[model samples]
Target: MLQALTILSLLFLTDFTMAASEDPAELGAGLQNPGYEELPAWFKTSFLDLTEDVAEAAAEDKRVLLYFYQDGCPYCAKLLRDNFTDREIVELTRQGFDVIAINLWGDREVTGLDGKTTTEKKLATLLGVQFTPTLLFLDEAGKVVLRLNGYLPPHRFAAALRYVAERHERTGERFSEFYVRTNPREAEGDLHQEAGFLAPPLRLGDNRRKSPRPLVVMLEQPVCRECDELHQDVLRREAVALSLAAFDAAIVDVFSREPLQTPDGRETTGRDWAAELGIEYTPSLVFYDTQGREVFRTEGYLKAFHVQGALDYVATGAYRWQPSFQRYLSARREALAERGIQIDIMR
Candidate 1:
């Protein structure tokens, strides 16, 4: 009985040891010990005193490279271990940036410009920090020059840092222009292909003297996968493109920093206006009259044919008589087919 009990205890111990070894968080924490001598000289393993360091760096006209991370953040650990330790990234960052790492959920006290000391968690909350591994390039005055969220591989991270640094050196050019020039991949028709279809110039806004025609306003978020897919697949199709061009079309970024005036005459930020419109997801299409009054709204992804049918229903005001939008679209397509107008309604 004693021999059998000893064998079972050994098996339990072996299983526990193997489980701990395989856990990424546990392995990362073990490797991140403060006394670990393997860290490169350029990389500081210590927590940064952001209050003093950031202020000093800003006063010197040096860009502040602020990395916000949290304990048990797998992406943050990877960024620190791989990206921050890359030879090229370390060298470039040393030249132009004062790098600092702050714990997102840490209890460390940080002194503000107003001389008030606040915890790191409070500061993160105040700054709207939601994701781990957030990188911020800040100007001397503490204004954000560029903000990047999530994990990036070493090469991409280095390139992004260099792009921000070059933009900072340019005195006359705006960050947007500099970014496009420095990182052509982020320019229109490249990494940001969807930006091309967001033709705001075609929309009726306060700048217009007269309403050109009825409009369809598409409220979208930049990072929304559904929005990207819709733009790439359905909106880019030839039939849908031709159909959409018939009306005054506009695309509004819900997360834009600019202020927008709603149809109800309430002035709010673009983000707030989108929330007020009850848009909880991407690819929300809202049809409006020439006066910007909401006529109908559709949320979620739609295929090219369905989008075309919806546009027809809204354009002809057939939605009033139809019991449902989907039913209206079906009847509209059949009616158009009977009139010998061939429309591709597949996929």
Candidate 2:
């Protein structure tokens, strides 16, 4: 029954996507006009001073949602029309946080948390706002607690609000963990197949070809929405598709009983191994170094930019130098921008 509902949902969404129009205004039942900069009145009217905004939100006992969007971005429209327009979501936002919209390409002055003034575009660049509809949930101290890089459907978006509103991160559980442990959404996309992915009978311990790259074990399940998003948006990117060649990637169904040699050379069923590893989410990428030692892993729904960054991080061996993945990605984005290369971050 769950699977059937998931498939129906997918079909519904597919039809909606296929019926898009060239004119942005005509796209969402004429709910949006392209180039219009108006935002929800509930969104705080700030002096564009992030420090003050954060302080005010803190005083009100609320988190701050920094929404970075552009005028014509379809994902932004979905977020605005499909998600934000929902009365329940609006009320939830009002209760939990003070939402602020920042135009990614606007010239409006913004005083950042560092007490420095910059244009909205410059501030977005500084904060790595590579994708429209990026939502940064900030703590009282102005530190980013959670970052949503793309448009999430209503359920997942609501889950994110609850996660941050309830301060789940303070419990030392990752958002993916919290999400899975709480209200799991119905599946969105099916498990994606790629030619580069290793075929079944996956003996991950054996590298007879002596490949110098690391091993990436993708633990996923069929009809996983997060998994679908990864294949649809992230893995198809030229950079990520190319970067994947640097690693020996394998996918294992978390619920399957298929036997395989683990990275530590232990023979176990996929289900058993996933249980041992506590892989609570589909589309989780567990990176293992050349010697089969666990290096890094991302266990949640991530946008193309973040997913690609993970690939680059493991392939280029940057994880060894930078303790913070976010910091490394910032430096990487800055370097690419300085090189005059355009980044389609949400691709």
Candidate 3:
């Protein structure tokens, strides 16, 4: 449906930088690799100011992976659907890089390595990204040390993670030279939009003004498969879906600079608000009560049951008394079980 679209967030101790094409139809045409808005939860919430991003990542003892792709690229789809879905690969990348997605064909403003503002398409050209799913691994100084021209299978992708994570380049181990020789896993999941999610052109200001329930702000990117899974596999399920209905949901871009009224009655851009809150990861769930005060927040990947519990915690006002979320969840499960309701944490 989106004929005109551009670039996309969940960050780990997460942050993101972007102006994106947020349309699923255009994100990958038939491929299903959406933009950064659907990206997984581990990516750091960043300003897209590469210099600041590099400094922040280094402060956190993390490196950076500047991922370049465009709409309708099959290899890009494979990278998200296959490589990133691998648990080991996800965890390995999580332990190492703060991944940022950049659209090779987008026109969104990007703050370049030289502290100059440019569009995504221009920057991609500057980086010489001739293919979809090009990955530029940057060191602490924001300098590219390794560049993978196109998609690498899961095994090689795993090796890439290790190569960068362990500083293998310092040992003179080339990526192609040290490639992990093993069978690759096939990709999984149908790339579809998260149904029942708060639809886009998110009018978050209106949400705060109209709803009396707590606010649930989902900081996401289009390329986030985990975010996709949360909707496709988890949030759309019966119980969790109902649980989420209690809040006024709004999906926000981590990299957006557009100003809006926040839940706490402050006027700020999403990027500035995210920075102010020190958001570290993608697909985060930040909750606010009727008074616009933040009551609770979940900053990274969480299973269905926990996500539901987090929602319930705020909805039921459990956070007011039970400071320990773990304790509250334990008591919740016990109470549910006593009533003959069994909770499936994963499903």
Judging by TM-score against the true structure, name the best candidate: 3
True lDDT of residue 196, candidate 3 = 58
What TM-score does prediction 1 earn?
0.43
The predicted structure with the larger TM-score, 2 or 3, is: 3
TM-score of every model versus the real structure: 0.43, 0.47, 0.53
The 10-residue segment with the lowest total lDDT in model 3: 6-15
Ranked candidates (lDDT, high to low): 2, 3, 1
Can you list the residue pairs that collide in candidate 2? 188-225
How far out, in Å, is residue 234 in model 2? Answer: 1.5
Q: Write the per-residue lDDT of candidate 3 for residues 52-157, one digit (tens) a residue.
A: 8888778888899998886557787668755675556788988888998887867677898899999888899998989888999999988898899998876677
Indicate the residue-level lDDT of 65 in model 1: 78
Error of 3 at 202 (Å): 4.3
lDDT for model 3: 0.74
Pitting candidate 1 against candidate 3, the one with the higher TM-score is 3
Superposed model 2: Cα runs more than 4 Å off: 1-190, 342-347
After best superposition, candidate 1 residue 79: deviation in angstroms?
A: 16
